[model samples]
Target: MASCILMQFPGTSDPTVTVIATGGTIASTADAQGARVPTLDGAALIAHSGTPIPTRVIDSTSLDSSSMRLADIDELAGHIQEAFADPTTSGVVVTHGTDSMAETALALDVMLDDERPVVLTGAQLPADDPHADGPENLAGAIALAALPAQQPGVQIHFGGMTLPARGALKRHTYEMQAFTSSATTPLSRPRPVGVHRLAGKNVVVIAAWPGAGRAEVDAIVATRPDGIVVAGLGAGNISADMGRALGECLQAGIPVVVSTQVPFGPVAFDYGGAGGGNTLGSLGALSAGYLSPGQARMALTVALASGTDPAVLLA
Candidate 1:
């Protein structure tokens, strides 16, 4: 699954752009279930972009977002690093599936340290749809990546809207414009030090439910995952029972992260209890800040593999 293919699209002797494809809706065709599946590759997506420039295409993987794993992300980042090293390269555009685009974008945002645009774009409709948005989004991504004055950072560009990868989220399922950010303050997740390969990192996400017992957390701890991201209740609160379980995980040397299940806001210690943010803090559980549970999972997965103390990294 760690294979990459260099593609030959119509090129220009002028500024060069690199279009990297991973499997996503932009590359998908319809399946019998009527769901748009990830069946297309980078070559197909680049052709849809209308020959933007002298472009280099790399197909990192074709797995749908749900099928995406840590290894695939590591490989993708490696290719981006190599491509961006070329001085003539203006920027890099990524074609991905929207289902897990946020996690991938967030992963790239922290792991890469380059001065070129890394635009990840995906489509709500599949390539076979008459009303697909992949081409336009891809073209826009190229435009942004090729911008001489565009500031460098990982970003998600979709449906005429652009935002930083740290704060981007898939807010809607079927809507064409699925990703969004805070209306007031644009935020970024914890700065990623460098790319970390999650080959042996064990991580899991456990959501808190009303009256839920600590058994869920105990079960996770029993397996001894490297890290855990618990999507807590309102504003990062969890059940008292689960809070104790998290404490146990920390005691066992496993890093536990607390994040909000909601789309916005940071996890703070403004309250107190066995499951309160303050209690979790006292138990050595770290905060995910404004990152959603999914993003927190990615951050923890990478940071653990990189040997960065979760407390310092999440702090």
Candidate 2:
């Protein structure tokens, strides 16, 4: 909350929502050579979209979403929690890029399981485009953040739809409707309040592809990641050889999370044999029910960072 300014929106008394800007296409504009670059900060974007209630602005980062990394997201989480801890702020809206919006949103949802509204919104078109969609999307995000949704979880507000971070995904590349819920519905949201307390860890996600085997796992383990997530095939199934290597990961004291590479549905133990969900379960890998591999990684990272064993989250 230090150095953060209460926005002077015309004709407002009480500040209710705080817009945390992490550079995304919403704040980007075209360069001389037609390359898009993040040039607008949170305050400028808010100026275009306008706000209903009194609000504040915090310029967190100005990097392109594609250039963002896990460390940057961890820092952004701290900023959002700081805003939430402010007694005057009732809700928070996050303006991010579409590239990693789902991952950031899911991290907040898992780490901050509070009742406060944490809404994420971004744009597909750059701010400089005549047909840019950032303004309406920003307005929608602000409105969602200001309302008491009564549900406890992180949310992505775009295209007039508010979805839970648990199941939100960036499904499209060029479309404004960039997100889709692989699950039947959103799981509501979570966000740690009042501090950047999330644990810092090296977590990796390895997906199952044709001809993939133990070699991939060996390379991943060589880096000594704190945790590993398997983007398994249908029903969370990995190759037999890869499964053995994952067991080695567990034996090394590094936790492994099992999530499906498929678009939707929960991981089931219906299959048995090498590389099947049952084998991974026997090897002590945790299943992320219906969570995408990226989202599962976020959950594991948060849980491990908090010093909580993620075994309970497997359920």
Candidate 3:
């Protein structure tokens, strides 16, 4: 997690909410020719909202989601960890890009220690646009954060709804309602009273599993592969071709992790399916169960980076 600073006035009725501005289209403004460019700080963006919530802008440097790396995500988590430690700070809001937004959100979900709602928001267009969606999303994020409801963990608020960070994905390239929850109405919803009536389902996030994509898989098959996933189609399914690759990885002492690509489901084997899951399981490819791919990757990376057995993640 990155370091942060809290700026607030004493005796102010306003409740302080740390707004870490990581810079995205929401912070961007139109250029002279009307192209998007990064602009605005937390104060400037929230100044016109007329809400008494105090916001603190901890970081301003902006980067496209493609350019953001695991290290940057770690730093963002650092800032969030610091804010959650402050008793005066009610909650935190992170403004980021829609692209790769779910990845960061999920990353934070795993790293977060407290239950304070960490609201993430962004826009489809620059704030300079007359029809920009930044303001509303921003407002919705803060409003959710201020609520007393148990809207904890990493959740994304956009297009007027609050969704679990793990269940969110960018489904459209340029629509205001681009992000959606997986076959559900989302973990939380906005109300005249505040965010309420959470669906109360826990989203499992598994990562750092041993032999997820490299060693254990290589022992099962014999091929240099392009990509590897835990299951096939929506559940426990990986193609025969992929199964062959996993066999190779397992044989070569490289590990492969079996994670479901589906937003909701588990990675199981031999459930009377024709997909290669049973075959892959027999070949020693580790199953990630209900963990999302992002979580699995992190777990694997940490284990691999530390030179520990990737198999430990299966536990």
Candidate 4:
């Protein structure tokens, strides 16, 4: 079990922002092999943030964001829930890896039903770097988390912008301004579903290509996943053979979600034919709307684990 450390700043009477640190580049230091690894904990990150906000730091997992699993997300959500249980805790700040931060933000956005803010932030450069952006990003997240009049739900605070989690995507690999969101409004707040572990629920994402076919879909279906999300081509259209294979999965009681490979815009039912979004919808596959494939996968995993209908939640 992870331990919590209460860091009392100058203002004891101020509402507290609980900082939960799950290691990412913000807390990482380069190893002997010149590869960065997570080495700093929540307390260290808060210190680096240089913020005066009263806070309670919890040292969660130390891991690269790419190494995170569904179970890890479940654990992180549990920590956020625990932090919100305290009446003095006004909001929460999560220091996460940029690689998978958007997915975690989406999970928390849908899972928690709190009015208080939940801000996720991380750095693109290692903590030890002279021009590291972790401190500034962490400072912004803390400020957002500490805002008394902030809108509810989860958001990513990075590169000076606070983006809603629903359609958030990491657009740049190593840039300070890494995330972008096309969603204009907050997601409908879901009733708190307590803690749901997605360990056993298997959901996979398959990218559609120019000539993707049944063999590609067959290989994934052979794994017998609980659900499948197709990152289809423009307007969520797959090749005829790929669409047929996905249709079969739907017939077998597997949920299929159609998302677009394009960075912006929603998946539209603008085309018809074997591989069209309209055809996939007719075959019982749900459209992911504006969701990126990664966000769709997280939403699908949570929905399946919580016994929520993917059609109602995802489509």
Candidate 5:
């Protein structure tokens, strides 16, 4: 079910803020059987903030980000649009599940028409946990949302840091400092100044490539011998089907980047030569080194957007 909590900023004359809840661990509760049950909403989260802020429960059910479809993202985009359209709505906060949180945040970043601050927050543990991070994350998000300078683009706030949607990634399963940005530093940090550093003009998304296509995979090598990071199979392998396609791109003298399909490790060429490893490595494909898939993508995009040599991606 859905419910909400409202909390206004204490002792501040600032305008009210609206938090839209797309339920996750924050709203979870415990059933009589002791199983986790999340039933609260945005308003409930606001109430948990200990101050009354104008809040709304846009959606009550917890939607895992990985399970989220393009349609769901579109729906969220619509809500964000509507929320910003209202002059009374200063900023918006979205409570979301950690899975695919970066993807959802990125989608919102691309789709949101306005510049109003839009923040996405969630927890790794349920609200009932003594160590649950949902409440504090929500509080931080709301605090940022109320700020006038936080406007424009979408952001993910967790563990007291704010990250740009297109750049944020969940780096840990249990650590409070889980979400991070690649290459660029985080936008907001709760410190002495509590600054949210907006990105420079260099951030961007390139035209959708055929590899990001739905059906068969295809490779697109940009004009420069730029770094091309492939989300490879286990141990940095590529499926036979994808290997053939990527081989064609590599033979053209383009650098192919290989990143592990898994989230946590480096894309290594040390795996057995089977599964497109030998084939790709022989073609001068480079490993992503320390960069995650999302980080690799962002680095590539920004480099491209900046018109820098793709070779710089390796640097």
Candidate 6:
């Protein structure tokens, strides 16, 4: 069972922000072996934050975000939904691992529809470090979540910036400011999908290189995944052979979403050759637009799990 803690400070009002701790560097400590591991819970994290906001903490999962699966994300969504169901809950702050924070945020953005803000935050340094950034980031996320006029939908609050979940990406391996997004606002507003589980919806991401071809696509096709996301070149362009193979997958009724490997810009339909965005689009592949390849996978997973058309929902 998950532990729940309600905290009320002096001069605070009703309707408290819910802090859902799913374990990350924010809740991690160095083990005897000198390796960092998630050991702290939501209550401990809030105590470290030192933020005096009327708050409720739910210890959701103790995980190093890299170990999280789609099923784990779905379970976290249930906790968020339960928190929102309460009238006294103002907003939600999710303490997550920075590795897959953007992906989880995107999944929450598509899974839940609410006016209250859902802010995801994590630390680059482990909590035991003397210069750990978790407390400050958690305080910021809590402040954002507690704001009555905060913009709704899922957002990532890290290194002092509030980023929309859709295009948020972790750009650095070890930096205080780790995330960046190209758009000020979400590129597309998808309808909230009610997902029960993503058990068998095997969505895979394939990166396209200078010479990636049919062999790559064919290998992925052999696995018979429920969906595919092609991390194509600039403007979502792939090799002609890869495009032809992807078209065959499309003809076989497998949904393919095209995204870019570049850090910025939307996947466009500019070129019309066999491997261009135009070609992929013509072959019934949905363009991921501003979403990263990881985010596109989450969106496609949710779409497939909910019986929603990937093209219609992603558009």
**Candidate 5: where is the Cα deviation over 4 Å?**
1-14, 32-37, 150-152, 184-230, 233-241, 245-315
Better of 1 and 3 by TM-score: 1
TM-score winner among the candidates?
Answer: 4
Candidate 2, 73-131: lDDT as tens digits: 77777777787777666688988988888888877776764567889999999998999
Q: Per-residue alpha-carbon lDDT of model 1 for 1-315, expressed as tens digits?
A: 544444543443455678888888889998998987788777678777685455777878886888888887888888888887777778898888888899888778877877778899988888999898888998888888887635456899999988888767899988878998632466644556787677677789999987778988888877878889999887788888888888888888888899887886678776688888898888788888877788888878878777776654454
Off by more than 4 A, model 4: 9-14, 184-194
lDDT of each: 0.80, 0.79, 0.62, 0.87, 0.60, 0.88
User: Candidate 3, which segments miss by more than 4 Å at Cα?
Assistant: 1-14, 31-35, 48-50, 183-238, 251-255, 259-275, 286-315
- TM-scores, one per candidate: 0.92, 0.91, 0.71, 0.95, 0.61, 0.94
lDDT of 6 by residue, 21-82 (tens): 99999999999999989999998899999998889989889999999898788778989989
Candidate 1, after superposition: displacement of residue 3 in Å?
7.2
Q: Candidate 3 overall Cα lDDT vs. reference?
A: 0.62
Q: Model 6: how far is 77 from its true place, Å?
A: 0.5
State residue 269's C-alpha deviation in candidate 1, in Å: 1.8
Ranking by lDDT: 6, 4, 1, 2, 3, 5
Error of 1 at 64 (Å): 1.0
Residue 103 error, candidate 4, Å: 0.7
Q: What's the ranking of the predictions by TM-score, best on top?
A: 4, 6, 1, 2, 3, 5
Model 1 alpha-carbon miss at residue 245, Å: 0.8
- What TM-score does candidate 3 reach? 0.71
Candidate 1 RMSD to the correct structure = 2.2
Candidate closer to the true structure by lDDT (higher is better), 2 or 6: 6
User: Which one wins on lDDT?
Assistant: 6
